[model samples]
Target: MFKTIKNDLPASIVVFFVALPLCLGIALASGAPLFSGLIAGIVGGIVVASISGSSIGVSGPAAGLAAIVLAAIVTLGGLENGGFEKFLVAVVLGGIIQILLGLARAGIIAYFFPSSVIKGMLTGIGIIIILKQIPYFFGMDKNPTGDFSFLQVEWDNLISGLLNSLNALLSGNISVGATVVGIIALGILLLWSNVLAKKAKIFQLIQGPLVAVVVGIIFFLVTQGGSLGLLKEQLVSVPVPDSFDSFKGQFSFPDFSAIGDKDVWVIAFTIAIVASLETLLCVEATDKLDPDKNVTPTNRELIAQGTGNIISGMIGGLPITQVIVRSSANIQSGGKSKMSAIIHGFFLLISVILIPTLLNKIPLSVLAAVLFIVGFKLAKPSTFANMYKLGWKQFVPFMATVLPMAITGDLLLGIGLGLAVGIFVILLKSFQNSHFLHKEGEDVNDGKVKMTLAEEVTFFNKGAILKELDNLPENSSLELDVSKTRYLDNDIIEILEDFAHKAKERNINITLVSERGTVENPPSYIEFFKLRPKAS
Candidate 1:
C-alpha cells in the first residue's frame, strides 16, 4: 500500500481537507453533536479502509442517511432522553446486520445494476455537488455541506434554498471577500490540475486544493478587520476543546439499555438496508472511476463498513457508508491505495487535536471552489453527449437516474426509477429480437419463409413470435430453425404449438429444424423440446 505513498500522501491531504467540513456539517444536519461526524470519519477511514478490499473507496458519515438519522433521533425520545445515545445503539446494530448481509453474499445484487444507471448515478451526484455548492461558492451557504437529499434538514429544498440565497445576494447581502477567495482558489485548482502539475513534479506533490486552502487562510489573515473581512460563520467551524480532558468529553458511548427497544431495532434495520445499498452502489461507481479500473469486493466492503459503523457508534458517531464525494476526491487527487484513506483518517484525528484552530481559519468558500471542480469533472457535458450517442436504450435509463437525483435529491429513488427503465428496455429488446426472418432468395421464390430463433428466447419473446406466426402468408411453407438457440422459454414453446394448430387451417407446411433433429409438421412442439437434451 505504501508503494504509492508519493501519490497517496498528497491525495490523503486533499481528502482530509474535503472531508473535514462534511464531517461537521453532516453531524450538524443529523442533529447529532458536531464531534460525532468526525468520529465516523476517523473510523470510516482508518477502520473501514484497513479491513476493506476496496483500494480507492473512502467510507464516512453519509449525507444520504441524514434524514433517517434525524428522524431516528427524535423517535428515540429526543436528545434530552439520550436520543443521540440510543441512535448510537441503532448504528451498532445496523453494523451487525450489514455484516450478516455480507456473510449471506448479498453483495451480488450490485452486479445487477445497469451500467447506464451507474453512469447516471455518477453524473447525477456530480450535478448535485455542483448545485449544492453554488450557494457556498457565492458565500451564501445556509444549509449543511453534505446534505444531498431533495428536502434538507433545514426544511427547504435545494431550489427554494438556492433562490433564497440568490435573493439575499441580490439585496446587496453578498460576501465579497468570500467570493474573491473562492474564485482565486478555483483558479489555482484549475491551474495546478490542468497545467502546473504537468509542468513540474513539485506541483503534483503539493496538490492544488491544499494550496488554495493555504492561500484562503493567508487571505483571511491579511483581510482581518477590513471591509472585505470574512465573518466567523464564513470559515471552517471545527469545535475547539480547552484541553485534552475536555476533548475526551466530546466522545459519547452508545446506550445499550435501548437494545431491547423495538423502535431501536426498527431503526437498526433501516440503517442496515440503506447503508449497505449506498455502499454497494458506491463500490461499483468507484471502480468505474478508478484509472486502473480495479474492482472492489462488494461483500468485503459491506463487512468493513459494518465494522467501521460498530466502532463509530461505540464512540458516538453517525452511520457510515461508502461516500462518493470523498472517494471521487481521493481518486482525482491521485490516491492509489487504501493507505490514502487510512492516512486521511489519521489526519482528521491529528488535526482536530493539534491544528483545529488553524483549520477554522480556512474559508468555506475555498472548499466550495474545490468541490466545484469535483462536481464539474463528474458531470462534464461530454458525458451527457456520450450517453445520448448510445441511443435511447442507454440514454433513457441514464436520464431516469440523473433527473430524479438532480431534481428531487433522492439517490435511491432515482436509481430505482432508472433500474425500472433499464429493465423495461431489456424486455423490449428481448421481445423485438426473439426471432428474425431470413429473406433468402430461393426460399422467398419458392413460397417458403425461414425464421431463425435467437440464441436465447425468454417469455418476453412470446409476443413477437406469436405476431410473426399470425402474419405468415397463407399456404406458405415455414422453416423454423432453432439450430443456434440454446435456451428457449416454455412460454415460447407454447406459442409455437398454438401456431402449429393454426397452420393446419391455412394449409401451411411447418418444418422444424434443430440440432436434435428435423420434424415435418410436428404434432407437439413442446414434446419435441422435451425430447431435446436439457442444459446440464
Candidate 2:
C-alpha cells in the first residue's frame, strides 16, 4: 500500500482539499458540532483507512446520512439536552450492529444490485454533485456543500436551488470576487489536468486541486476588503481552536447513560443498516471506477466501517461511511492504494491542529470548480449512449435509477426504483424464455409438437409452459423435452402431470425425453422425476 507514496501523497492532498469542505458542510447540515465532522474525517482517514481492505475507498461523515442524523438528534432531544451526546451512543451501538451484519455475511447484498442500477447511481450522483455545486461555483453559496439531498438545509430542492442561484446572479446578488477567483481556479485545474499534467512527471506530482486552492487563497488575500473580494461566508470555515485545552474540549464523549433508551436502539439499528448499505454501494462503485480493478472485500469493509464508527462516536464524531465523492476524487487524482486515504486523514488532523486558519482562507467557489470536473467525468455523455446501446434491459434500469435520483436527490430511492424495474424485466424475460417450441412436424415428420424446457425451469415458467400445453391440437403427438433442464421446480412438474391427464382425454400421445432416457406414456410424472438424480 505504501509502495505508491509518490502517487498516493499527491492524491491524498487532492482528496484532503475536496474532503475538508464536505466534512464541515455535512456537520453543519447534520446539526452536529462542526468539529464533530472534522473528527469523523480524521478518524475515517487514520483509523478506518488503516483497517479497511479497500485500496481506493475513502470513509468520512456522509452527506447521505445528514438527514437521519438531524432527525435523530431532534428526536432524542434537542442538542441542548445532551441530545448529541446520546446520539453518539447510538452511533457506537450502530457500529456494533454493523459488525454483526458483517459476521452474518449481509455484505452479499451489494452483489444483488444490478450493474445498470449501480452505473446509474454513479452517474446520478455525478449530476447531483454538479447541480449542487453550481450555486457555490457562481459565488451564490446558499446551501451547505455536502448536503446531497433534494430538500436543502436552506430552502427548495435541487432545481429550485439552481434557479435561485441563477436569479441571484442576474440580480447581482452574488460575489464578483469569488466568481472571478473561481473561474481562474477552474481554468488552472483544466489546464493542469488536461494539458500540463500529460506533459511531464513533475506536473502529475503536484495536483491541480492543490494548485487551485492555493491560488484561491492568494486571490482572497489580494482582494480582501475590496469591492471584488470574497466574504468569510464564501470561504472554507474550519472551527479554529483558541488553545490546546479548547481543542481537547471539542471532543464529546458518548452518553452511555442513555443506552437503555428504546429510541436510542431504534436509531442505532437505523444507522447500522443505512450506513452499511451506503458503504456497500460505494465499495461496488469504487471498484468499477478503479483503474486497477481491485475488488475490495465487502464483509471486511463493513467490519472496518463499523470499527471506525465505534471509535468516531466514542470521540464525539458523526457516523462514518465509505463515501463515493472523495473516493472518486482520490481515483481521479491517481491514488493507487489505501495509503492515500490514510495520508489524507493525517492531513485533516494536522491541518486542523496546525494550519486551520490557513485552510479557512481558501474559497468555496474554487472547491466547487474542482468538483465540477469530478462530476463531469462521472456523468459523461458517452456513458449515456453506451448504456443505450446495451439495449433496454440495461438502459431501462439505468434510467430508472438515474432520473429519480437526479430529480428527487434521493440515492436509495433511485436504487430501489431501478432494482424494481430490473426485477420486473428479469421476470418478463424468464416468462418468455421458459420453453422453446418446435412446431408440429418440424423435428419428427410424425406431426409431433415438441417443447424444450429451459436449463432451469422455475415456478415463474409455469404459466408459459401450461399455456403451450393447453393450446395443443386434439389427437396430436406431443414431445416434452427436459434434456437441457438441470433443476425443475415442483410447480412445473405438477403442471406437466395435469397436462398429461388433459392430453389423454384429448387423444394426444405424450413422449417425455430426458438425459436419463425417453419415457413412453409415463404413468406418474412425480415418480419419474424422483428417480432422476438431483442437480449438483
Candidate 3:
C-alpha cells in the first residue's frame, strides 16, 4: 500500500481538502457538534482504510445519514440532557449489527442491484452535489460552510437558498471576495487538470486543490474585511478550544444507560441498514469509476465500515459509510491503494489538532470551486445522454433514481424506487415469455403443443409455465424441452412434475427431452437434476 506514496500522497492531499468541509457540513446538517464529523473522518481514514480491501474507496461521516442522525439526536435528548451522547449508543450498536451482517454474508445484497440503477445513483448524487454547492459557489450562502443539505437552511429560510442565490446574482448581491477567489481558484484547477498536469511531474505532484486552499488563505488576509472581503460566515470553521485540556473535554462518550431503551435499538437498526446499503452502493459505484478496475471485497468492506462506526461512535462521532464523493475525488486525483485514504484521514486529524486556526481562514467558496469540478465530473451531460440512448429499459430506471433523489434528497428512497422499477420490468418479461410455446401442427385446436424452456428458469417463471400447461387440451401430445436449460429452480421443476402426472390422467401423452434423458411421468425432477446422466 505504501509503495504508491509518490502518487497516493498528492491524491491524499486533494481528498483531504475535499473531505474537510464536507465532514463539517454533514455534521451541521445532522444537528451534531462540528467536532463529531471530524472524529468520524479520522476513524474512517485510519481504521476503516486499514481494514477495507478496496483500493480507491474512502470512508467517513456520510451526508445521506444526516437526517437520521438529526432525528435520533432529538429523540434521545437534546444537547442539554446528553441527547447527543445517547445517540452515540445507537451508533455503536448499529456498528455491531453491521458486523453481524458482514459475517452473515449479507454483503451479497450489493450484487442484487442492477447496474443501471447504480449508475443513475451516481449521476443523481453528482447533480445534487452541484445543486447543493451553487449557493456557496456564489457566496450567497451566508451560513457556515458546514450546512450543505439540499434543503439548505440559510438566512432563516429552509428552501429559499436557491432563489436567494439567483436573486443575489440579479441584484448584484455577492460575496465579492469569495466570488473573486472562487473564480480564480476554479480557473487554476481547470488549468492544472487540463494543461499543467501533463506538462511536468512537479505540476502533477503539487496538485491544484492544495494550491487553491493556500491562495484562499492569502486572499482572506489581503482582503482583511475591506469592502469586498469575505465575512466570517463565508469561511471554513473548525471549533477551536481555549487550551489542550479544553480540547480533550470536547470528546464525548456513548451513554450506555440508554442501551436498554427500545428506541435506541430502533435507531441502531435503522442506521445499520441505511449505512450498510450506502456503503455497498458506494463500493459498486467507486469500483466502476476506478481506472484500474479493481473489484472491492464487499463483505470485507462491511466489516471495515462496521469497525469504523464503532470507533467513531464510542468517541462521539456521527455514523460512517464509504462515501462516493471523497472516493471519486480520490480516484480523479490519482490515488493508488488505500494509503491515500489513510493519509487524508490523518490530515483531517492533524489539522484540527495543530493548525485549526489557519484552516479557519480558508474560504468556503474556494472549497466549493473544488467540489464543483467533482460534481460536474460525476453528472456530465454525456452521462445522461448515454443513459437515454441505452433505451427505456435502462433509461427509465436511471431517471427514476435521479429525479426523486434530486428532489427529495433521500438516497435510499430513490434507489429503492429505481430497483423496484427494474424488478417490475423483469417480472413483466418473465410473465410474457418464460419460453416459446407453439403448436406442432398447423391447426392449433387439433395439434400437439411444444414447450421450450429458457436457459435459466427460476421461481419467477412459475406463473407463465403454469398458465401455459393449464391451458393445454386433453387428448393431445405435449412435448417439454429442457435441452438448453442450465438451471431449473425446484419450484419450476415441481410445477412441471405435477403437470406431467396430471397429463397422464387426462390421456395426454407428455414427451420430455433433456441431456438427462427422457421421462414420461417423472417422480421428481429434483432427483433427476441431482442424478448424473447415464454413460451411454
Candidate 4:
C-alpha cells in the first residue's frame, strides 16, 4: 500500500479535488445539506475503497441518485418532523438489502441488461447532468442543482429554454462574477484535459478541475463586493460551524421508529435496487477501463457499497454508489490501487474540517462548468451515431432509453421502456422467422410445397405456421419437414397434426418428415413425437 504512493498519492490529490465539488454538487442536487455529500465522499473513498475488490473504482454520492434522494425526501415531508431522519432510516435499510443481495450473489443481474440499454442509461444521465447544469452556467440561481425535469425546471422545449436563459442574462438576471469565473474555469478544464494534461506529466499530476476551483476562489476574492460581483447565494454555502465541538452537532441521525413505516420500506427497497444495479453496471464499466485488466468480484463490490451506505447513513450523508466519473478520473490520473481512493477520502475529511470557510468560496458556476464537460463526454453526438450504425435492433432500444429519460426525467422508466422495445424486437424477429416455405417440384399451385420448421418453434410461431397450412393450394402435395428442428413445441406439433387431418379437405396429399422415418398419413403428433429416442 505504501509503495504505490508515488503514483497513488498524486492521483489521490487529483481525485480529491474532483470529488470535493462533486460531493457538494451532488448534495446540492439531492436537496440535502452540502456537508452530507462530503461525508458520503469520505466514507466512499475510505470505507468503500478499503473493502471493494475493485482496484480503481471510486465510490461517492451519485448524481444519478439525486432524483431518488430528492423524491424520498419529499415523500417523507421534508426535513421537518423527522422527515429527513426517516429517509436516513431508508438508506440504512437499503444498505442491509444490498448486503442480502450480495450474499445471494445477485450481482449477476447486471449481465441481464442489454448493452444498448446500459449505454443509453449512461448517455441519458449525461444529458440530464448537462441540462441540470445549464442554469448554473449562466449564473441562473432559481433552479436547484439536482432538478432535471424539463417540465418543471425550464420552458416547453430545450432551445426556447436556453434562449430564455440568454434573455435572463441580457436582463441582468445573471451573476457576472460567476459567469466570468465559469467561462475561465471551463476553458482551464478543457485546455488541461484535452491539450496539456496528456502532453506533460506536470499537467497530468495537477488536475484541471482543481485549478478551476482555485482560480474561482481567487476570482471571488478579487471581485467580492464590486457592482458585478457574485451574490452570496451564487457561491457554495457549506454550512460553516463555529467550532469543532459545534461541528459535531451538525451530524444527523435516523429515526429508527420509521422502520415500521410502509413508505420507508418502499423507499428503502427502491434505493437498494437502484443503487445496487448502478454499482454493478459501474463495476462492469470500470473493469473494462482498468489498465491491468483486473476483474473485480461483483458480489464483493455490493458488500462494500452496502457497508459504505450503512456507515454514511448512520452519521449524515446522502446514499452512495460506485460513481463512474470519479472512477474514470482515478484511472486517467494514474491510480494503480485502492490506496488512491482511500487517500482521497482522507483529503475530503481534512478539507472539510480545516477549510470549510475556504471551500465555501467556490462559485457554483465553476463546478457547473466542470460538470458540463463531464456531461458532454458522456453524451457526445458520436455516441448516438455509433448506436445508429448498429442497426434498429440495437439503435431502437438505445433511443427508446435515451429519449424518454431525457424528456420525462425518469431513469427507471426509460430503462423499462427500452427493455420493452428490446423484447418487442425479439418477438418480431421470432414472428417473422417461425417457419419457412419453399417451392420444389414445379408450379406454385400444382406442385410440391416443402415447409421447413425452425430449430426451436415455440408458441409464438404457431399462428404463422397455422396460417400457411390453412392457405395450402388445392390438389397440391406437401412435405412438412422438421428434420432440422431440435426441440419442437407441443403447440407446433398440434398444428402439424391438425393440418394433416384437414389436408384432404383441399385435396392435398401430405408427407411428414423428421429424424424419424417419413409417414404418409401422419400418426398422432404425441405418438410420433414419442418415437424420437429423447423427445417427450
How much lDDT does each candidate structure score?
0.86, 0.86, 0.83, 0.78
TM-score of model 4 relative to the true fold?
A: 0.73
lDDT by residue (tens digit), candidate 4, 121-197: 77887787787677777778644344233433456645566677778867888777778888999999889988997
Which is the winner by TM-score between candidate 1 and candidate 3?
1
Candidate 1 residue spans exceeding 4 A from truth:
142-144, 150-155, 431-536
TM-score to true structure, per model:
0.81, 0.81, 0.80, 0.73
Tell me the tens digit of each residue's lDDT in model 3 across 466-516. Answer: 667777787888778777666554446655656666777777887778876
| Predicted candidate 2 versus true structure: per-residue lDDT over 1-536, tens digit per residue | 77899999999999999899889888988989999999999999999999999999999997788889999999999799999999999999999999898888788777666678888999999999999888788777754467466545555676777778788888988778878988999999999988999999989998888889999999999888888788788888888889999999999999899999999999999999999999999998897788775667788999999999999999999999999999999999999999999999999999999998998898899999999998999999999998897678779989999999888788889989988997787676554343443343443446578777777665445445655776778888888888877766554675677677777788999999999999888998978997888677
Measured with C-alpha atoms, the lDDT of residue 60 in candidate 2 is 96
Q: Which portions of model 2 show Cα errors greater than 4 Å?
A: 142-144, 431-536
Candidate 4 regions with alpha-carbon error over 4 angstroms: 1-11, 28-31, 62-64, 71-78, 142-166, 169-172, 288-293, 332-334, 430-536
Q: Pairs clashing in candidate 3?
A: 25-146
